[model samples]
Target: MKTVVITGAASGMGLSATKLFLAKGWKVMMADFNQEAGKKTADELATRYSKKQVAFHKTNVADSSSVKELKNATAKFFGVADSIINNAGIFTKGALHEVSEENWDRIMAVDVKSIYLMTKYFVPDMIKQKAGTIVNTASISGLTGDYNMAAYNAAKGAVVNLVRAMA
Candidate 1:
């Protein structure tokens, strides 16, 4: 069976993707920053499927060490991943000049750096196997300038280009 590793698997698009994959009979490692929510989602999926089909590991995708731990846990539980969904990201809203440095950093770390971290640890194994897919979620904001989401637009734009370059 194919196995997928998804960051931000506790909610939103990530959660929806998890359900779809499980329904298709794929094993999934759900990595999310919120431990309680991640575990709860995994538990519910586990019941609907099987315990072995779902696993949750609390992860801070912005941090290299945390991402490495997530990679290791996935390897231990489900072997090499066939796909990685870099779905963990944050949104920030402000005028270009009004965006604080801290908020800019936070948005970049979660939305852009997390993709780099995930790829750093997972891509080599994918190469070794001669197969794998990496999906980085981006928004329409990445395609056009927005009034109040400068940081979000910039970060997501980076992700769009990064994925294209990777391809």
Candidate 2:
């Protein structure tokens, strides 16, 4: 069976992808920062898809060590992942003067740096196998500016271009 790592898999697009991958007969490692939600979702999915097909790992995508740990866990649980969906993201909107520096940094870290971290940690196995896929979820906000959302727009914009560069 194919293996996949999907960040933010507790909800939203990540959750949807988890379900779809399970339906397609792929083993899924569901990574999320929300431990309770992540565990609950994993348990429910396991009931539907069997425990062997679904597992959960709590992850903070903004942290390098956390991402590395996720990679380690994936390898231990299901061998090399055939794909990773970098779907974890947070949205914050504020005027340039109103946005805190910390908020700006967080936006960049979670939205952009997470992709870099995941690629750094997981792509090596793909290279060794001569096959892999990376899916970075970017928004229309990335292509167009938003009012009071400079930080979010900038981060997503970086993700957009980074996806291009990776391609």
Clashing residue pairs in candidate 1, if any? Answer: none
Give the per-residue lDDT digits (tens) of candidate 1, residues 38-144.
99989999999999999999999999999999999999999999999999889989998999999999999999999999999999999999999999999998888
Evaluate model 1: give its TM-score.
0.98
TM-score, prediction 2: 0.98
Per-residue alpha-carbon lDDT of model 2 for 104-145, expressed as tens digits?
988899999999999999999999999999999999999999
Worst 10 residues of 1 by lDDT: 140-149
lDDT at 89 for candidate 1?
A: 87
- lDDT of candidate 2 vs native? 0.95
**Which ten residues in a row are the worst by lDDT in model 2?**
92-101
- How far is each candidate from the true structure, as Cα RMSD in Å? 0.6, 0.6
